[model samples]
Target chain A: MKIVKYEDIVLKVKLACLQMTTDLPQDVQNKLEMMAMQEDGQLAKQMLDIIIENANIARQENRPMCQDTGMVVCFVKMGQNIQIEGGLLADAINEGVSLGYEEGYLRKSVVNNPIDRINTLDNTPAIIHYDIVEDDVLIIEVAAKGFGSENMSQLKMFPPAAGIAGMKEFVKQVVIDAGPNPCPPIIVGIGLGGDFEKAALLAKKAAIRNLDEVNPNEKLLALEKELEVEINNLGIGPQGFGGKTTTLKVNIEMFATHIAGLPVAVNINCHAARHIKVVL
Target chain B: MATIKLETPLTIDKIKDLHSGDQVLLSGIIYTGRDAAHKRFIEVLEKNEDLPFDVQGQVIYYVGPTPTKPNQAFGSGGPTTSYRMDAYTPPLINKGLIGMIGKGKRNDEVKAALKGHAVYFAAVGGAAALMGKCVIKAEVIAYEDLQAEAVRRLEVKDLPLIVVNDIKGNDLYVEGPQSYLKEHK
Candidate 1:
């Protein structure tokens, strides 16, 4: 069995939180650069340039790229052969989040309760998803998801009759309706199949996937390309100032579903798509 | 496009001269508030009490900044989504709030209120670090308990913005997209 100390996990999570908040991922930065060159509108081009400059400034100064440092979401793959010593895995991750936010001077955005609306102060109790795997290693993928785009996400449990065409239309409508609110030049993640919650989780995962990575599924890859073109045609542009680049990329993930149910979820991510991964 | 230079406590004549899609470099003192602080502002108004600051001809930026590090005037500060504060905005606008700096769309009532001698400007959302450099000074003036959502008085120099909504009811979000669609078609 492979043994990992609880404090080790805490340190990794804390560093990931601090690093991801300030540094724009390389793939996202590349996509932004490419889009900036392709944009037809002067305003759109200017906005993209400013966004690139902002990323550079954040990196140079080690400052949070955006004021909304976001709620930390961690997806963990834990092997059955691995044993965590010192404390529970969840507790370790939460402690790391609190320390990371405090030490990095990141905003404590979490509220203790939705209704009560009081600040948690430490940005604790990160949203964690666990998957047990056969390998003896533990992998943690972290995403700092801002709410401007999160608020724009939507899910639909469509009947079987809705089909691919219905799904396409639904995705298009979601982006159209979102307009300027979610901060345009967005990344779209589509999750198809499974039940409601699973689809949403899949969409969230898809949203944080690296832009340069290729999808192994040929059909879904083609669909992603088609949707990208269609959405850009909507002319939402950078910051919705209007241009050919409304979305930087469209990523889709799918799974098998019940015969009667065709569930779909869409998660929109702003240009500051912040995520990082660590393996131990 | 020529960039317009603007100062705070905007006049009616200045607001009327502005148009949708105009780039602006703003300077002088402005107040900051987002969801929680805006709610408190409304509550205070409902109680027939004075606001933490005078609203007349002043601009309220919809932002909740991160905590500042040593030797910095402010941390990464950028505009939040403006639509969330739409419900509370019309009342503030009616109380002589002449300008707003934020990102994204405002509701119809807020747009109408803009027609009543106000303007809405959109800063590049998510460009917080770059935006922070423009804030020469920041101090929390009210709702200290709200933490990041506290009302702050900020002095900014050459803070970049785009006029999204002008007093004549022009909306850049609508026109900018429509124009692009037309040109491509």
Candidate 2:
């Protein structure tokens, strides 16, 4: 069995968080560039230009891409053959998040309690999801999910009779109702089937997938293309100013559901698309 | 297609002349507040007490900027979603708040209130780094414990904003898209 120091994990996690938030990913950059070329309305094109310019400034100056530095979400896929040599895994991750937000000059946006709403100040206790893989390598993905788009995420437990077409309309309506609120041109992540919780998780995973990545499964890939075209046709455009390219990407993940269940959840991320992954 | 330069302590007369879709370069001091700070401002009003800062004819920008680095006036500051503050907006407009700067759409109540009274401006939401460049100074004037959500006074120069809602009830959120759809189709 291989052993990794807890401190190293913390350091790596911090860098991933900072780099992902500070620097817009290449996949997102290229997608935006293409969208800028295709944009019809001059106003929409100008807004896209400003977003591109902002990404450049954030990368050059090492500043955060947006004011809502967002909540830290760390997805860990742990290996069975490895042992961590220090404190609790979640604790180390939280420590890294706190330091990363601090060192990056990112905003501390997390509150201590839902109702009381006190600023935690350190941006600690990140929302972490874990998976146990059958290997000796540990993979971690740290993402700063700003709430502007997160607030627009929706989950619905539909009856099996709702079918695939129903699911598409539901997801599209969420984006349409969201309008300018989620900061379009947004990325749409749809988790088509599963139990309630799994559907939500799959949608989030879909949202975190790189904009340029292709869904491995062929059927889902087809569905992804169909949904992507449908969403952009809504004419909700960038910043909801109206034009082509309402969404940069639409990714879908799926799982088997019970006979009577067809749960669907949509997770929306704005053009910023801040995420970074590392393996050890 | 018109370009306008506006100063603070805005009177209804000044904002009334503006219409939806006009571009404006705004300068002077604007207050910053989000959901929590807006709620607190309402609370102060309910208690019949003065707020930490004045609101009359002042513009409140919905932003919670990142922390500033050394020798910087501010960090990456951009407008947040506006509708979150919808419930708290009319009260401020009633208190002579002349302008609200944010991204995204406003609710019916807020739009109704803007008629002949106030205006809403749109700043590019995700363009934080570029927006921060326009802010010449920033200081937290109230609710320090709220951290980024605290009310701040920001002095800006040539801050680019588009008139989203004007005094005559012209709404870009609705009209801008309608025109675009027509032109493209």
Candidate 3:
């Protein structure tokens, strides 16, 4: 069995969280450049330019691209053949998060509760999702999810009769209603076929796909294109200032589900889609 | 569009002429407050107590900034979503506050109140890093226990912001799109 020290995991988690906050991934950068070329609206194009420049400035200066900085969300995959040599695995991850938020000078946005509402000084208790795989390596993927776009996400379970066309309409309506609020030239992540909650989970997960990458499933890819076209048709261009480039891309992830359930979830990721992956 | 610079404790006629699309560089003291602070402020208003700061002709920025580092004035400061303040806005507008700065659309109730009170402004949403640079001074004026949610008075200079909403009921989100929307065939 492969043995991994707890200290190593803790350090890696902390590094990953800090990296996710202050850095914009290279893949997202390349896609934004490409989209900037294809964008037709003068204002939308300018907005994209400013966003790209803002990202560059943030990176060069070691500053956060946006103020929200977001809540820490980690996706961990543990290998079945490996054993953690130190304290609990979860505690290690939490320690990394605490160190990263404090040392990185990233914003502490986590509130104690939804109602009484108190800010948790150090961003902690990261939202973690785990899966055990056959290999020995531990993989951690974290995204600092901001409040603007996260607040716009929605999930709906439709009757079987509603089908794909219904989904297209729902997504279109959601985009129209969302208008320029979620920050246009946004990425739409759709989760189909899973049960209600699972669909939402998958939808959020689907956002990790590179903005320019196409889904492997041909049918799903076509849906992505169709939805992109329909959403841009809303004329809600960049910064909601209007133009033909309302959405940068539409990504759909699907799974098999019960015969009677037609569950779908739509998670919107703003232009600043920040995430990072590490293997230890 | 005219660009104007004003220190705080200004009067209504000064802001009344400003419309959506005009640019403004504001100097002087503006209070920072977001969702939770708005709720609390309205509660104080409901009790008919003196507000933590003078509200007459003052501007409230809908923001919750990152904590300031040692000796730093403020961390990255940017606007939060405006709709979250929708429920409490009309009353604040009814009081003498003349301008509100935030990102995103306002409800019709808030829009009407803006027209009635001659108050509205907006800033780009994700421009926090750049925005923070413009804040020259910041200190917690009230609700220190609220931490980031506290009402801190800030001094800003040449802070760039586009007017998304105006006292005239003009809106950039609606007009900006209508002016630029193309027919898809």
Candidate 4:
């Protein structure tokens, strides 16, 4: 059995939090650069330039790229043969988030309660999803998801009759309704053919998926590409100032669903796209 | 379009001259507030109490900045989504708040409130690190308990912005995209 120390997990989570918030991942950076070069509007091009420059400044100075450091979301693949020493895995991850937010000078965006609306101060109680696997290695993927885009996400349950055409229209309409709020040029993550909550979670996963990575499912891959084109054609552009580049990419994740219902979730992510992965 | 340099305490004439899609370099003092602070602002107004600061001819930046690091006036600071504050905005606008710096489209009421008196500017939303550098100074003026949501008086220099909604009721969010689509077609 592989043993992972609790403190070690904490340290790694902390570092992941700090690094992800400061550095724009290479794939996202590359995509933004490509979009900037191809963008038709002068203002859109300028906005992309500023966003690229902001990424650079944040990295060079080891500071957060955006003021909203975001609520921490962690996806963990736990090995069946692995044992965590010292504390619960969730606790360790939360500890790491608290430390990282405090040490990195990131914003404490979490409120203790939705109704009470008091700041949590340490950015704790990270949203964690766990999957048990057969290997001896533990993998943790951390994403600092900003709310500007999170608030723009939408989920809809359609009758089976709606089919692919209806799904495409709904996704397109979500982007149109979102307009500049999600901070275009944006990445769209789509979850299809799942139950309500699962679809939403899948959409969240899709949003943080590596930009350069292609979808393995052939049909979904084609759908992603087609949606990317359709959304970009909408003229939402960079910062919604209008241009040729509204969306940088569209990623779709699909799963089997019930015979009666077709559920779709669209999670929009801003250009910042902060996430990191660590294997232990 | 040539970039216009605007100073704070904006005049009606200056606001009227501005148009949607104009790039602007705004300097001078502006107050920062977001959801929580705006809520409090409305509550204070409802109680007939004075605001933490005067609203007349002033600009409020909708932002919740990260914690400031050592030797820095502010941390990465960018505009939050402006629509969340829409409910509280027209009231503030009526109270002589002449300008707002934020991201995204404001509601029709905000657009109407802006006519003849105010303007709405969109800062590049996620460009917080770049935006924070423009803030030369920052001081929490009220609602310190709100932490990042606290109202801060900030002295900024050449803070880059685009006029999204102008006093003449022009909305760049609508016009900018429409123009781009036309050109591409």
Candidate 5:
């Protein structure tokens, strides 16, 4: 069994938070530049230019790209052979998040109550998800989730007859209704199959995939591409100023479901899409 | 397209001349307030006491910024959703505040209030880091207990903002989309 020191996890989490929140990952930058060239509307193109400039300024200055630096969410994969020594694992992760937000000058956007809505101050107590895997390494995936795109996320349980066409229609409608609010061109993460909550989770997880990646299943990839074309064709454009590039990518992650149900969920990630991973 | 650079406290005449959709480069003193601050401001007004800051023609930014580094003035200062403050805005408007800086839609009541009084403008939503460059000076004016919700008196220079709502009741959120939306054949 591999023994992982608790401080090591803390260090990794802190580094991951700072890196994810402050920097625009290269894949997203490449996609943004590509979309910029393809964007035809002058106003939408200008908005895209400003967004790109924001990314550059954010990276160079070690500042957050958006003021809504977002709540911290960590996806942890624990290995069967690994044992955490020293401090509690969750506390270490939270400590790392607090340090990262403080040192990086990112905003503490989490409120204690959604109703009273008092600020949490440190952006601590990240929303964490853990999965025990067969491997021997601990994998930490940190994503800085902003409110704008998150507000636009939706899920619906469909009848079995709804099928692929229904899913496509639902996604298209969501994008069209979302318009420029999610910050186009968006990455549409479609989660199919699974139960209601699981489908929603799958949709969110799908957002973490790289923009350049294609779904491995050919039929699913075809559906993704078709959905992509229809969404962009809506003319919602960048910042909803009306342009050709409404979506940068469409990624679908599916799972086997019960015999009687079809579940679909859509989670939109803005152009910033800050995420990073660490293996320890 | 007209721009004004002014210091507080503002007069109604200065803001009355301004219309919605007009570009302005604001400089000098402005206050920072979001949902929390607005609620408190209204609460104080309910007690019939003077607001923490005089409202006449002053601009309020609907922003909750990240805390500053050790010596920096502010961190990641960007606008929040304007609509959240819609319920608290009309009363502030009647009190003499002239402008609001924020992103997204405002409620009809807020629009109606703006029309009743000459007011409304917005800074770009996602442009926080870039916008921070223009905020040359900032300090907490009142409600320090509010933390990020505290009202900050900020001195800006050439801060770029578009007039989204005019005295004539024009709304850019509605107009911008209407003008650009293509009809699907």
Candidate 6:
């Protein structure tokens, strides 16, 4: 069995947190540059220019890109053949988050309770999902999810008979409904065919995927292209100022579900699209 | 859209001249408030208690900026979604709050109140760092315990924004898209 120290995970997460906040991933940057070239509206293009510039400035100055630095989300893929020495994995992750947010001077955006609405101050209790795998590798995928785009996400359980057309319409409707709120030139993530909660989770993970990563399945890739086009056709554009470049990309992740249900979820990721991955 | 500049304490006459789609640069003093502070503002209004700051001819920016880093005036400060404030806006407007800076769609109530009364400006949503640089000075004037949600007085210079909604009921969120679609077609 492969053994790793607990501090290693904490250290990696801390660095990832700082990196994700200060740097806009190159894949997202390339997509924004391409979309900026394609944008038709004068104002939309101008907005994209400023966004790209802001990303550059953030990286150069070592500053957080947007004020909403986001709630931490870690996707941990644990190996069955490995054991972590020292502290609990969850606690280590939260510690790394606190250290990173505080040290990096990123915003403390987490509230302790939904209703009580008191600030957590440290931005802790990260949302974590675990998957057990057969290997010795512990893969940690971190995403800082800003609530602006997260709040615009949608989920629907349609009858099997509702078919692809209904799925398309609903996804499009969510983008339309979101408008300028989530900040357009948004990435659209669709999760199809899973059970209710699974679909929502899949949608979120899909949203965090790099824009350059196309689905391996030929059919899914084609659907992604179609959805991307349909969304851009709506003219929501950059910051919903109106143009031909509404969505940077559309990512759809699917799974098999019971015959009785057809569940779908849509998660919107703003142009920032912050995420990082580490394998140990 | 034309570019326009407006100083602080925007007057009704100046606000009347602005139609939707004009690019705006706001300079001088403004107050920052978000969901929690707005709620408190309304509660204070209800109790006939004086607001921590005067409301007349003032602009409220819907933002909760990151805490300032060393030697920096402020952290990345940008507009939050405006529609969330839709419920609390009318009361603020009734008290002569004339300008608001934010992003996203506003409801019918906000539109009705803005007509012949106030204007709404759209700051680029994710352009926080750029906007924060425009804030030359910031101080938490009230609700310190609310932390980021505190009502802070900020001195800004040429903070770029778009006149999304103005008196006479012009809404860029609605009209900007429709005009673009028609022109493209």
Interface C-alpha root-mean-square deviation, candidates in order: 0.6, 0.9, 1.5, 0.5, 2.3, 0.9
TM-score of each: 0.99, 0.98, 0.94, 0.99, 0.90, 0.99
lDDT of each: 0.93, 0.89, 0.80, 0.93, 0.79, 0.90
True-contact fraction per candidate equals: 0.87, 0.84, 0.55, 0.93, 0.41, 0.62
Candidate 6 lDDT at A184 equals 78
Error of 3 at A204 (Å): 0.7
Q: How accurate is candidate 4 locally (lDDT)?
A: 0.93
Alpha-carbon shift of residue B49 in model 3 (angstroms): 0.9
Looking at model 1, the pairs that clash are none
Which runs in model 5 stand beyond 4 Å of their true positions? A115-118, B1-23, B181-185
- Clashes by residue pair, model 3: none
Output the better candidate (2/5) by lDDT.
Answer: 2
Give the poorly placed runs of model 3, Cα more than 4 Å off: B1-10, B182-185
Q: Write the per-residue lDDT of candidate 5 for residues A79-122, one digit (tens) a residue.
A: 89999999888998999888888778777888898798777778
- Give a tens-digit lDDT track for model 3, residues A1-280: 8998899988998888767665778877787788789877776677778678777867776777788888877788888998999788889888988898888788888878988666778887788888899979788888888878888888889998998889888888878778777766688888998798889878888766677576899999888988888887787887787777777789999999888989989898877788888788
The local lDDT score (0 to 100) that residue B106 gets in candidate 4 is: 91
Instruction: Give one digit per residue, the lDDT tens place, for model 1 in A151-251.
Output: 99999999999999999999999998888888878999999999999999999999999999899999999999999999999988999888898999999
> What fraction of the real A-B contacts shows up in model 5?
0.41
Model 6 interface CAPRI class: medium
**DockQ per model, Cα:** 0.90, 0.84, 0.62, 0.94, 0.45, 0.78
lDDT of 2 by residue, A19-101 (tens): 98879999999999999998988778888998999999999988888988888887899989879998888988999998988
Q: What is the C-alpha RMSD of each candidate to the true structure, in Å?
A: 0.7, 1.2, 2.0, 0.7, 2.8, 0.9
* lDDT digits (tens) for residues B140-173 of candidate 6: 9999999888999999999999888889898888
Model 5's chain B TM-score?
Answer: 0.88
Which residue pairs show collisions in model 6?
none
Chain A TM-score for each of the predictions: 0.99, 0.98, 0.95, 0.99, 0.97, 0.99
Off by over 4 Å in 4: none
